[model samples]
Target: MSKLQIESALEILLQSLQSNSVMSKTFFWNYLKVFCKEGFLVDLQTLSIALVEKQAVFLIDSIACLDYKAAQQLDILVLS
Candidate 1:
């Protein structure tokens, strides 16, 4: 795979996936296979709830699929 494709895959995972739930190892490993055809790997051992929240925050800031009013409501809920 090209560098662009690898970067695109990682961006999608880091920006688009949900955060308010469990992340199966299989899910990540599957995507890893698609982008990393060689020796690359994800450091699963370093994952934590904080990491999930950080990713969620990134997803929220991107505002890719949210309705404006709904996004506002969610922001309120998150702050609350």
Candidate 2:
């Protein structure tokens, strides 16, 4: 994806997360997989803040689906 596309997608994902959508949690998990594969760097602090703000179980479950390496790189283990 182009940089603009990634940024747009991130915005959408963050909105979905903020709304506490269960399907968006799955989308976030899948997007994270793509980020890991494509070597994209997400803003961990922003994402963490969104997750914490929602306090959703589906969000936590999505974090559980992340692989160790990706989780470590994203520093998202704290969310799980």
Candidate 3:
């Protein structure tokens, strides 16, 4: 799509997100982050498709381990 059209669609999505009745802030916040991180925000169609895909959710603290032992601890928590 043209730049103008893409901008318009994003504006509409933003408006919908801003509406209290239609959007969940937590869900949208996570979704927006993932979309930007995965480079899925360039086209509206891709965003629409990605939104429906399976998503992984885990506690931020649970995934914080950097060393092998720490990772094992996190992995145990995840498995348990």
Candidate 4:
């Protein structure tokens, strides 16, 4: 996908997350895993910063549910 398309998709996902709607933890983590496996670095970075800035407790809790591999991938993305 083009960079613009990736960014747009991430924006939409972020909007959904910020909407205060209830999202299942399993589903949310799975969505994030997809993004990580697809190597959506920019999107992940944007998402990480947004979640941190917003102090998203949901995000923090979800991190604890991640498997080792997914957590490692996310750690790399966040630390890079």
- Please state the error at residue 71 of candidate 1 in Å: 38
Per-candidate TM vs. native?
0.30, 0.40, 0.29, 0.39
lDDT of 2 by residue, 1-80 (tens): 44555455556556666656778777766776675456343555444444455443244344446555544544454445
Give me the runs in candidate 4 sitting further than 4 Å from their true place.
24-27, 42-80
* Cα shift from native, residue 31, model 4 (Å): 2.0
lDDT of candidate 4? Answer: 0.52
- lDDT for model 1 comes to 0.41
Look at candidate 2 and tell me the lDDT of residue 29: 68
TM-score of predicted structure 1: 0.30
Worst window of 10 by summed lDDT in candidate 1? 40-49
The TM-score-based order of candidates, best leading, equals 2, 4, 1, 3
Candidate 1 structure quality by residue, lDDT tens digits, 1-80: 34444345556566434454456444644554443344222322122122244454343342324234434544554555
Among all candidates shown, the one with the greatest lDDT: 4
Residue 57 in model 3: lDDT? 21
Model 2, residue 4: C-alpha shift (Å) = 3.3
lDDT of each: 0.41, 0.52, 0.40, 0.52
The true-versus-predicted C-alpha distance at residue 30 of model 3, in Å, is 18
